[model samples]
Target chain A: MQYLNNIGTYFLMIIELFRKPTKWSVMRHLILKDIDDLIIGSLGIVSFIAFFVGGVVTIQTALNIDNPLIPKTLVGFATRQSILLEFAPTFMSIIMAGKVGSFITSSIGTMRVTEQIDALEVMGINSLNYLVFPKLVAMAFYPFVISIAMFLGIIGGLTACVYGGYSSVDDFITGIQQDFQPFHIVYAFIKTFLFAFVLATIPSYHGYYMKGGALEVGEASTTSFVWTSVTIILLNYLATQLLLS
Target chain B: MIEVKNLHKSFGDAHILKGISNTFEQGKTNLIIGQSGSGKSVFLKCLLGLYDYEEGSIEYNGEVFANLSEDKKRDMRAKIGMVFQGSALFDSLTIEENVMFPLRMFTKLKKDEMRERASIVLKRVNLEDAHKKMPSEASGGMQKRVAIARAIVNNPKYLFCDEPNSGLDPKTAIVIDNLIHEITEEYNITTVINTHDMNSVMEIGDSIMFLKDGLKAWEGSKKTIFKTDNKIVTDFVYSSNLFKKVREAVLKEQG
Candidate 1:
């Protein structure tokens, strides 16, 4: 019942968030700052993680093929498929659910604790729009981040496959291009966009409505990350079943 | 001027503010003073339209607040400034940007113009040299002064403060109270402050409203509060030993 109530309030907040548009001059600065915080700032970790994890996934896939009859090209195919289908779009988002989600929650939660939200309200600003909308706008660029992850993951996998002697570079390239479908990219990006929305909003919901003091801000951040990851996983399943199946 | 008539607020079977009525005059420091849990904060929130009451009406300049449309309400709110208990400065921004926030939100002034306007208010609050500093680097008194600068930068007609001096030393608290008082008179704003600080009460309680268990128990000014015989008001006001002696000294002097 409480979950239902929270869901209802979340939708209402989304509605209210778009209603009173803040002056674009202020919103422009806010949006750029959010892009810097949520997107550009995330590039370093995303690149490092994507590269190393892709190598690990390739090495693992190469080892799993003990059947001597299996083609060497299959290693590259599996790496490409995994990186594009789930690793880049879904798994990377779970990582962001920790990084970006906690940031939104704690920053906004601290503002609530310090009565900055009330100050905005008393100033007649729609605190929701002022605080959350820019984040939403910035997260629209989440696909850009995922694209980098996808590119780096494939590069990492190619390096592992060729250096590990699991497959020749030409065979891996052929495997990557053998059955490529453009729609797979579209589907992955669709999931990325939906997860981006979830990442921006679920954390904001926790932070904006959080009560108590500093202790609760930490708690809200944990809860928000859990909820964001849960929502992204659920949405991934639903989107796959609906779009791919 | 702001007027509240029989304002009532409740929270899920807990009646917080019950039929409280008062008029806060313009150009003066109007205070709502009460013990903890007496609904003083709730009353101020209701006046600021942060909380909606179930009954009665709140009027600003003779226009009923609850009757205004959403757009009109927002426009009215833009004319009102608030200083929060924690000084609520945007931690990420420099002091100058914090003061310039309202202008950016509500006006089309160029960046230089906004900076100039922000400087004027920062200077007014004696923070001219602190523009590049962040809120985290500021002392408690400096933060309070920055809050005052932010509150008045937009030239609001009404100003509301929630415990404007909660965590400061006695001297700094008095300084904040005096700043609010001076700004109230200077801007002719309808200022409403919710506080229990005895120093603030004695220093700038131009028109004071005493709330007891969510009801208005007494009403008077700084001088009149010193002489009030209402037991509820007297008990709460003179509970501290120092204020008790001060009250007795004032009474003896009068006699």
Candidate 2:
């Protein structure tokens, strides 16, 4: 019952977030700031995680297929599939649910604690729209970050495959290109977009509704991280089942 | 003027405000004074339309708030400026940008115009040189002054302050009180303040409403606050021995 209540509240909040829009002059600055905070700020960590994980996935795939009868190119195939199909979109979002999600939650939760939200409301501004809408708009660029992750992941896999003697550069390149479905990129991005929405809203829900002081802001951020990751994973499973299976 | 009629508010099973009604006049500092848990904050929030009251009508310059449409309510709210107990300045922006925020949101003024207007208010609040600083870098007194600057930057017709001097030293608190008083007269605004600071009550409370457990225990000006024999008002106002002796001396002098 409590879960249902929260879900209903979250939906209501999303609806409120779009209504009574803030003036574009103010909203423009807020959107730019959020882009800097939520998207641009996340690039470095996402790139680092994607590169190393892609390398590890390639090395592990190579070790698993020790038989000479198996084509060495299969290592590249598996790495490409892992990084694009799951690693770049789903795994990276889980990581962001910690980095970006905690940031959104803590920043907003602190505002709530200090009555900044009330200040906005009293000023006749729609606080939900003012605070959360920019984030939602910024997360529209989430796929841009994931695209970078996908590119770096493949590059890292290629470097590892060539350097680790897992496969020749030619074979790895062929494997990446071989039988690749354009639809998979679309499917991955579809999931990325959904996760992006989750990333922005779930944490905002925790932050905007949070009640308490400084200690509670920290607690809200942790809860927001947990819930955002959980929601992203759940949505990934649902999307995969519907889109892939 | 702001008038409240039979305001009532409750939270779940707890009734926070039984019924509160009072008129806060314009061009003067109107104060709501009560001990902790006496629903002073709640009453102020209800007046600001931040909370939904169970029963009551609040009239702002004779327009019943509950009767207005959402758009009208928002239009009304736009005329209000509030200074929170915590100052509630945006942490991300510089103090100058913080003061300019309401103008940015509500006006179509050019950036230079907004900056100019912000400077005017900041100067009014005696925050002439702190524009580049963040709220976190400001002292409590400075932050309160910035809050005042932000509140009046948009030229609101009504100003509400929730303990605008909460954590400041006595000297700074008096400065804030005097600033609010001056702004009230300058703007001819319907100013309502929620505070328990007796010094504020005595200094600038042109009209005072004393709430006890959500009910109006007494209503008077700062002059009458000392003269009132109402025990609730006297007990809360003179809880300190120094104030008690001062009240006694005043009574003797008056007698």
Candidate 3:
């Protein structure tokens, strides 16, 4: 019954989304804002994670390859698969949810508890459409851009591996070229899009329903971040099974 | 032009509003006065359809609000403008953008046209030069004026102000009160202000409804309010030292 009620609420929200044209405009503003935040806010972290993880993975994989019969090229294939299929979508979302999702939830939830949402309602504007829709669009689009960032980070790590005498640049490129399938990239993109939606929607919903006062808003933000990160991980596993299978 | 009949609202076991029924007339400043927990804000929210009342009917110009479809309710909402307590201005948008928000959302007005309408309303609230500034940059009183401008930019038929003068200096509070009153008269809008300010009651409360613990204790115009012998009403009105002194002076003259 509770699950049914949640579905019903989501359906109502979607219907409300279509009813207002301003929601689209608001969504545009939110998406642009998210893009800006992702660039300025998430860039350093993504680069740090990507560069270090890339270097560590390549080094560890190189050390583990003791069998002279096993091709040294297999290390690059393994790293490529890990970065594209798992690391970019899963770890990046965790980081983004902690940083971006928390900010979105707290800011919007504070507005909700403060009667700002009611103010919009009284002005003949739909607060959900104005507030949530923009966030939805932003989260949906920005992750795809971040995936590209993650891809570059992987390349940077591979370059470091070559400098460290772990693998030749030609061998690394050859391993990725031979093993990297279009479907892996597509799956990564799809997962990131879904992850973004969950991140934005869950937090916005929590914030939109926030009541009481500052304490409640704080609790909502914390809950949104925790739930969204968990949801993203769970969904990533499910998508991998469903799509990769 | 708004009538709330037998309104009752409860949060789980605790009842907030107990059968509140009142008529807010057109082209008049109707005030709801109460202490902090008297449920005045809840009553206003109930009227706006923000709070789902367990039982009651709100009729706006004879249209039942609860029975109306979402679209119809939205149409009614568009016709109503509200100035929220704490200003409630959008932090992300500039003052001009905040004022233009409803115009852009509700109407298909061109950008230039929306700007024109926003400017007119901003000037009406005496905020002609603060358009580019964000809500965070504005003073508390200035923010309240911007909120008023945003509320009235749509030229709504019904104006709802939830403690419009809250958190402002006395002079600024009067300015806001008189601005609401003047707008109510000029637009012939049905203006409902929720306040506990005694000075506001005297200045522009053409009609006043006093709520005590979620029940309507008294309903009368400002003129009759002074003559009321109701102890609760007197206690509230004369609670201020200035008003207490004035009341004593008047009684001495009579004696």
Candidate 4:
């Protein structure tokens, strides 16, 4: 019953976002701040993980190919497919469910506890719009982060392939270019866009509607991350089925 | 003037505020005092329209609040300034920006104009030097002052404060209470405060209402209370010996 109430409330919050207009001056500043916090802040962690994870994927693919008949180029092919299809978009969003998701929940939860949200409401400000809309605008830049992840992840893979002596540069490059479909990149970006919405609103719902004080804020953050990650994971599979499968 | 008629509110089976009726006069500091769990906060929230009363009409300056259109509610809310118990200044904003916030949102004033007004209001609260500081960087008293500056910066028609002196030392609390009253008179704004401080009840309560378990138990001016024979009011007012001394001194001074 509580879950159903949350789902209904989440949709209602989205409707509220469009009904009340916020001052553009304030909205612009809020958007810029959120971009800096959500996107730029996550760049370092995303890049670090992307690079190492890409290297590991390449090494694992090469090691698994025990047959002499399978082309060495297949290692690069498999690496590109894995990183572009699932690793960059889906996996990174899950990581962000922990990183960015926790941030959205705790910051907003703190505001709720501190009566800052109440202050906004009393001032005739739509607290939901003031709080959540900037985050939605900022998450529009999520794909930019994923684009960087794709670049760095592939670079890390090539570097690992060279160092591991699993495949030659030309062979790996051939495998990456082999039957490369533009539709796959399009599919990855679509998931990123959808995941971006989930990123902005799910955690916000938890924090905004949460009850209790400081300790509850922490608990809400944890619960928000869990639900956000689970939602992203489910939507990922759903999107893959609808868009890819 | 704000007139709440037969206002009743409940949270599920709890039934918090029951048939509360009162008129908060303009240019005066009206106080609602009660023990904890007496529904003071809930009543304040209902008056602010942050909570809806299930059975009552709140008339703000003669227009029923429930009858106002959504746009009108927004306009009315813009006129209502609130100083939360915790001050509730935006932690991310500087004191200057915090005070200038409502202006920037509701008015098309140039940035310099907003800053100028913020400066004047902050100076009114005796916080001229602390504009660049954050809320966390200020003392409890300074934060309450900033909250007041923010509340009044837009020249609101009504002001509400929930426990504005809850955390301050006695001296600082008195300063804050007096400042709020002065602002109320200076602006001719209808101001309502929720507090349990007998000092506040004795100090600036031009009109005081006491709530007991969500019911209006007593309603009178500060002067009337001193001469009245009501047990609840007398017991609650003289609950502390210090207040008793203060009341005796006031009576002695008056005689």
lDDT, candidate 4, A60-116, per-residue tens: 999999999999999889999999999999999999999999999999999999999
Local accuracy of candidate 3 as per-residue lDDT tens digits, A67-139: 9998767767777877777778787788878888888888888888777888877755667777777666656
Worst 10 residues of 2 chain B by lDDT: B17-26
Local accuracy by lDDT, each model: 0.93, 0.92, 0.83, 0.93
Q: Per-prediction DockQ, in order?
A: 0.87, 0.89, 0.63, 0.89
Judge the docking of candidate 1 as incorrect, acceptable, medium or high. Answer: high
After superposition, the stretches of candidate 3 with alpha carbons farther than 4 Å from their true spots are A1-31, A38-44, B250-255
Question: For all candidates listed, what's the TM-score of chain B alone?
Answer: 0.98, 0.98, 0.96, 0.97
What is the per-residue lDDT of model 4 for residues B97-185, given as tens digits with 9 covering 90 to 100? 99999999889999999999999999999998998998999999999999999999999999999999998999999999999999999
Writing each residue's lDDT as its tens digit, candidate 3 over B13-126 gives: 999999999999999999999888999999999988888999889999999999998788888888888888988898889999999988877787888999999999999999
TM-score result, candidate 1: 0.98
Task: Tell me the TM-score of model 4.
Answer: 0.98
Model 4, position A17: C-alpha lDDT score: 75
- What is the TM-score of chain A, computed separately for every candidate? 0.99, 0.98, 0.88, 0.99
lDDT score of model 3?
Answer: 0.83
Better of 1 and 3 by lDDT: 1
True contacts kept of 2: 0.91
Give the alpha carbon lDDT tens digit for every residue of A1-245 in model 2: 99999999999999999999998877898999999999999999999988989899999998899789988778888898999999999999999999999999999999999999999998878899999999999999999999999999999999988999888999998888877999999999999999999999999999999998999999999999999998898999999999999
